[model samples]
Target: MSVTDTEATGRAPGGGAGPEPAVLTRRLRLVLVLLLTTQFMLAVDFAILNVALPVIGRGLGFPLAHLQWIGTSFALCAAGFTLLFGRVADLFGRRRLFLGGLVVLGVSSLVGGLAQSPGMLIVARVCQGLATAAVTPAALSLMTTSFPEGPLRRKALGLNGALMSSGFTTGAVLGGVLTDLLSWRWAFFINVPVALAVLVIAPRVIEESRPEKRPELDVPGAVSVTLGLLAVVFGLTQAGEQGWSSPGALLSLVAGVVLLVVFYFVERKVAAPLVPLGVLGKRSVAWGNVAGLFAFATFTSLVFPLTLYLQDVLGFSALVAGLSLGFLGLGTVTGGVTASRVIGRFGTRTTLLLGGSLQAVFTAALVCLGADRSWMWLMLFAGFAGGIGNMLAIVGFMVTATSGLADHEQGLATGLATMTQQVGITLGTPVMSAAATTAMTGSGAVAVLGGLKGAIGVNAALVLLGVLSSALFLRDDRPAALRASRRSGHGRSARRKGGGRFRPVA
Candidate 1:
């Protein structure tokens, strides 16, 4: 049977819904491309403006302190609303939310590109974040639902992971190129075209999906969780830029923690909780998210200190410093593409162990860096190797995290994973930056070098902890869903049997 025909009929080659055919049809291939492209766009946007922050600030006449809002505004909104949007997609429709997010992204990017004032630009960024928050979970949930759990799904996710990592690497380069050649505004303008294109094509290619029976929206739970997340993320940003003891950081942290505590109680009492907290009890889901958090924390945090080593200590230009990251990017792409094969051969636990161990080793090796320019070769090698290991672990974490749930829970699963990832990314920079700052005891390149080494050491320590945790906790590779399906005789029956655990409220 043709792949497109199988997909169109919503059946396997043997006929009538069961496991998906273990082949990639042209139509399904197209869908994968479309979804993967969406993933790449989101990842790219995360880093695209980072390089252009200075240019954006000067163009909009932003005060030096306020310039951070360019990035923070987007991060805060995206991280805060991700969980809520993920569940919303499950209850409403993934395709609908995905398309809406694209429209919002395009419009916001256009406004950002045309902004005449810092406030206008910041507002646009906030909108852009909200758009991202919507699209990321929706697109990911769609990907999970579109491909059944098998090699095809593994391959798709590997590519998804690849695109995500590569997109970030590519964004830094593209941002630098666009900012230097055309304008910093091009970073925002660039997303407009991609968003517009995706908006036009996605409807034709993607299937619309939502739960069969919808539940009333969880308003109080959503508000509490969203506000809590926003406060925590804002506090982390503040703590990184200012000291942890700074009033802004301390107050935000305290408030966020309190709100989160309230959310926990609210979830327990609510008839229809936004997130079924029980999902966290699953070993794969809980441990997988922890793996994801550390993977991002280590990988993302390393860039900052490395940049300092390259530019401040070694006296490389900003462009050169950015370009130097190509080594790591190349490694990331290479790792992402090959991850599925490794997982398919070794299974998730082994893959996680291998990836984490390598990442920790390479991250620790970064201590070799100093004022000497000749050490660039070692740095490049370490970065490239580290990228491969990090992506492998990341893909494994994602695969593990989403493996056990019923269809209805996939959205929540992906949302949880994505949320942890954002949190990790947010936490890494500040923690590493603080470590670097604290370790600096002297002046000039020597002091900067000492700080960089200290940060790397701290990150290496964190990665080692991740490696240990995975070794201890990630004991199985078999998915709970597959086992349940085996016992029930079909995927649908398994879901039906298990669905009662999270029944919707009237």
Candidate 2:
């Protein structure tokens, strides 16, 4: 009875009157399938470039110094616009933006594949990131809006989180195969067919929805936050390449901090802010983001250094190194399939603790890795452990962070969720690199091996800090009301029927 405008109108059956519950449920499942497929393409887009970079540089004839732009350009644009576009989806229309983004992504992919020069390729990649920024939050908002808060949403999110994780590792292997077998251009061009399929199917499957009372755009908040995020991402990327103490990195970092502080004040004054300061004040959202930040940072930090160790220290080829990480993809898929069940039985917080604990253990285990140690253990089992841990942790973070918000603010919630991930990844590698470099032991292979151990140790510590924060600050994953319902049911069958409920916010 107290359902909001969106629940009442936007969620109305289909075009006719209203479909039966059975029919509606089926429709929702199809929608979920479409959304997850799109997510896979987006997530893989990032990783697919990794193994193809050298070929891309040669094809485009760019100087070695500028080759990084193929990837960095995408990161810069994605981190810059993700939040701003989140608000735009809420204000304009999520379905429209989501579709537009797919088109943009498709177009950019085509352009990139066909590009003849470095500048053209970089421009196309930047467009791909910009489109991804729009697509990510809009897609998440659509999923949250489509399902009620219960087993349904939990399962949906868990599966999505898994696919995203698996997509990354899978893309690494995919890129290598595509590059060696066909051409590097296929890495960019592959998105075209998938995007086209989603583009064709999405309109029929997904229903359009947006906030109830449209508000004016918060220009001040938007500009400040976007620039702040952009500066921060650029600074972190610079630090990864040029060291944190460099003048450019330091200046960008300083500017980003100043802009963000200004944005905070501006958001308070704005009639309709880009990000409500109040939403961020909530315990679950705030600490969930903190957890999400470390979850992403720690997992991503392992890839580059480990790649070096495999290829340089242990004498693996590029293709072998890339394929070895396939264990991570398997773990991610397995974790996704099981995370919702784990949450259903144990609870979100417990699952989160378990996940964080797993990640910490995985990274610490890597510290024992040596040149003589069988690559099979580290590359296969350890990679799988790390993959599952990161995926589970990510799903937990997303569920907790966005749980209590009103439907209208789901965009902002998803935006912040995406933003934390991007920022975490931006900061993760550089900080870990610094920690490892400070303790460098010897030269070439030996030095690289020793440095990686230190770096992985730092990663373990960061994840442990995340575990501490989750245990200390996050509100219980299940509300008192939901627990009461489950208690009343009191059986294996009833427990499966136990639906999630909410308590009043403090």
Candidate 3:
């Protein structure tokens, strides 16, 4: 089947639904499993090496500073390639691209597992990042097409979001355990089996899907945007090591902005823009992504700093520190699972408002925590609040952004949403990290507390701003009949398979 036909039929590209009687359903289930597994692997891979940093540094004979590159390389490549791969998925075939990524990821993981030098490891990681760039959008697009709209899609998407969140914390814990018991290499080695399984099963279960009408690839636009994002993120990362006033940092920042401006003009004139200007014109898409960036930024910052505080201040082992992050994951899962139900009753807008407000409140509360204080309960509460807020914002944004688009535009929509989230995390992390560093410049417990306070305060303000933007700017004025239809569709699906089966199409 052609890519467009496969996409239209809700089957992933390159994979044919078996006999007509039960093929699509069976294949879809298989595809779903593979997609989720790949996502989990990608998410875990992003953070797994963090806990093993010390071991990796000592074994590899690298300085502590250079060790950060292991993570940064992956992040940079992943961010840079997201749109490129996303467009590829739209033009070629999502399933084909997704499978290809799985192959690259598997090979990279193997290479990383057996790396004899830091350079080799970094190269492997970059390849893995490229693979991730392909897998994420394809997985999301598959989800978009596989399930019909309403509660089933919402629950599925919510679960998918929760799993992705959990994978980060899980990676840290798993990394620590593996590094201590087996070897740091196990972190990468683990992906081999997972990737192999996904590759083997995806073809049987997932339907291939692509745009009915393929748009021209915006190569120039893609390159400019990628370079622009890289420059900005690199500049931010550099500011931590070198002073913010450093010439290199300033130049990178300026160049990034300039390239992005050029990209805007390119998009405006292109027949088939990499990112359709109309997508950005929609308030829902714009605000949703903006909110996502801040939310993810807050999340990344919280985990990193808190991990350090637990180890340095609380004198916890890596394992203990990792375990502490479970609270955040737990909260995210709880929030994600419950968001669909809440949205069903309260309306998407109201739920988003509640989520944003709650997140802001909790983030502000986190600012009160001290180095010496055991704020376990408070931390859990805050984590829970943040999780709920993050999930709500993501789901709301995704649903709202794609609501008006045709099937052909689904890949672009997913890509745009993913890009914004990535950009938010990329830009927000260094800024928050800088805030923490600035706060803790002096060498005292008081200094550390002050820094933590500043970091949390900044995050809280961002959350508040996100809430305000969503509340004021996002509008869903579908007629009551349409809303009722959505609810009915969602309710029927929910009843068919408990509370966890809804999938919102628009």
Q: Which numbered prediction scores highest in TM-score against the true structure?
A: 1
The worst-scoring run of ten residues by lDDT in candidate 1 lies at 1-10
- Counted clashes in each candidate structure: 0, 0, 22
TM-score for each model: 0.92, 0.91, 0.88
Can you write out model 3's per-residue Cα lDDT over 1-506, one digit (the tens) per residue?
Answer: 22243433443444344222222344455556666777777888878998898898898887877987898888877877787777788888988988999899999999998998899999999999888888888788777766545565566677777778778889889999999999999999999988887777677666667756677789889999989888877776676557578888799889989998999999999998888788878776677677677667777667766776676666678788788778888877887788767766665666667777777887788877766647666776787777777777666666665556655666777777677666666667677777788777677666776777788788888888888887788775444755786777856766577666655558
Q: In model 2, how large is the Cα lDDT of residue 308? A: 77
Assess candidate 3 and give its TM-score to the true structure: 0.88
Model 3, poorest ten-residue lDDT window?
15-24
Give the CA lDDT, 0 to 100, for residue 193 in model 2: 94
RMSD of each: 8.3, 5.4, 5.9
Better of 1 and 2 by TM-score: 1
Considering TM-score, which of the candidate structures 1 and 3 is the better prediction for this target? 1
Ranking by lDDT: 1, 2, 3
lDDT by residue (1-506, candidate 1, tens digit) is 22342474345544335756667776788888888988899889999998898888788789998888889999999999999999999999998999999999999999999999998999999999999899999998888888877677778888998888878778888999999999998998988888888888778877777877899888999999999999999999999989888999999989999999998888888888988779878899999999999999889878899988888999998789989998888888888899988988777887888999899999999998868898999899999999999989999998999986877788889888889988998999999999999999989999999988999999999998998998899885645755565677776654577783534349
